[model samples]
Target: MTTSASPSPVLSPEHLARAYSYSAYRQLITTLMAEGKTTGTTQSEALTAYAQLNIQRMERLDKQVQVQPELLAAVQGLQQRYVWLVLTEGWCGDAAQIVPVLEKIAQASQGRITTHYLLRDENLDLMDRYLTNGGRSIPKLIVLRADTLHEVAQWGPRPAAAQELFQAMKAAGATHEEFAEKLHGWYAKDKTHHTQQELLRLINEMS
Candidate 1:
């Protein structure tokens, strides 16, 4: 009598569309633009549109497409570690792109994903303690194995945004076309990296 598990999120399209569109996505655009030396919402709309375009392409992929083999193994290993908590803002594009596929992977592995939100308006403690690298990016995934005193991973503690995406997508067995489309699309628009949590996820997915 084994019960089949669903993905941790169990998301609905309408719900995801709204949350990703207005929340995680918009914030990601704001952050990417702010990463530059200048600071202003002067081109906010353009950034939003650009980010949305890339996300939309991914969402259009048939959700039923089998989870990639590499991604499946990673999900299994992470699940064994205990509930992996994903702390992200709803408006982040990284959250939108990376999380959805991870969600897909988790579903296949018996649904062991846990997530939280760290909005700019509230809850910066975890970021201060865990992700002290730079601006606490959304989708800053944190993996905790319970036996350790410290957290597992933080995103973008380095350079080369495209490589991060390539690695993550590659882990999921995402095709060169899939990775290239998402990577170049964001790169052309200017972008950032996945957190350590997500970086592991990318590797796990690619396996």
Candidate 2:
């Protein structure tokens, strides 16, 4: 089992905008990471802390989001069993930002939340189980139950449409080199947004 450093989750979203936010969130994430690296906090301990923090967030959000149908249903489902697995690189903005929201959701779902932070470079074997356009993308959030893998939910880097640009480069007689350059930049720039969108796809597909 993986261990994370924290009294609660130091969600990935902080990593994305850590340098940008004035909130204490960034410091929390850094501290969590440091603790995990140094103190060897077990997975369950980290997850329990993550759950405790999100429980408060959900308690607050409940007042406002009580009417959301999907949210309510997700909350109900979580009341049963919830396991959250996140695939991310520290450099990913989406993971740093969105994972906190997930923590909150798990809380609302009724105290059933567990978070596993897997560094993408360190976890190729796991990523191979998930495929998109012949590639594996980051921040794939998977929820499971018991020892059985009943995937109620999952998410990943979004598939963006570069078809227009791909075609434009083709028509312009641009080499594959030009196309690759533009495509790479696009993915890098909109990485977070893509993760959110891809997350929707994974959930929909799995559901």
Candidate 3:
């Protein structure tokens, strides 16, 4: 006689919530401000700008964004718990756009997922371990098993389509402001659909 495989166990909300290294969203903003204060000491224009930009991004993300229904549904379907350790800095425009969405995904997953934020500068060793094209990129998401914290899968900086577009624009020598305008517009139009679709694919592959 043929036997059916048993269903996987689902974690309770308490267990699920505990599985992630939770951070208050405001903490990220505070950390960025601190980084700005410290790094601004060097009198670097780029570093100072990064800090200021990230602060602005964090404030907007905290106030305005919402997770779409499809993302919520996708997050809810995960079969196992994961600790999503994200390497990011506040000044990262991509992080500003993406982090809030990630926060939403974790909330939707019940106990199946939790997100922890690590500043890229603060976690250089770990960031080097997951470099994009030999450069340390911010907002890299590393998925780990909740029980062992072993690496499972990793995703980052931006969605595939956006990455492709940005690379093309860079190759064509578009200005940073031009790139930002196009990218933010694309993100607004897409509304995390591409991000959600890509993440769902990754989860399914790892599962």
TM-score of each: 0.46, 0.45, 0.76
Q: Which runs in model 2 stand beyond 4 Å of their true positions?
A: 1-70, 77-79, 150-152, 159-207
Q: Each prediction's Cα lDDT score?
A: 0.44, 0.47, 0.69
Predicted structure 1: lDDT? 0.44
- lDDT, candidate 3, 65-150, per-residue tens: 66666666767777778877787665677887788777777887897898877666655656787788788866788777787666
Say which prediction, candidate 2 or candidate 3, comes out ahead on lDDT: 3
Q: Using lDDT, rank the candidates from best to worst.
A: 3, 2, 1
Instruction: Summarize candidate 1's per-residue lDDT along 1-207 as a digit string, tens digits.
Output: 011223232222332233332335345545664553111223355445545554553454324335655555666665444333444443344555555544454465664443332342244544454453355554444443333313343343222465566568868999745854786577335422332234445445423
Best by lDDT: 3
| RMSD of each candidate relative to the true structure | 11.9, 12.8, 7.6
- lDDT of candidate model 3 versus the reference: 0.69
Superposed Cα deviation of residue 98, candidate 2 (Å) = 2.0
* Highest TM-score scorer: 3
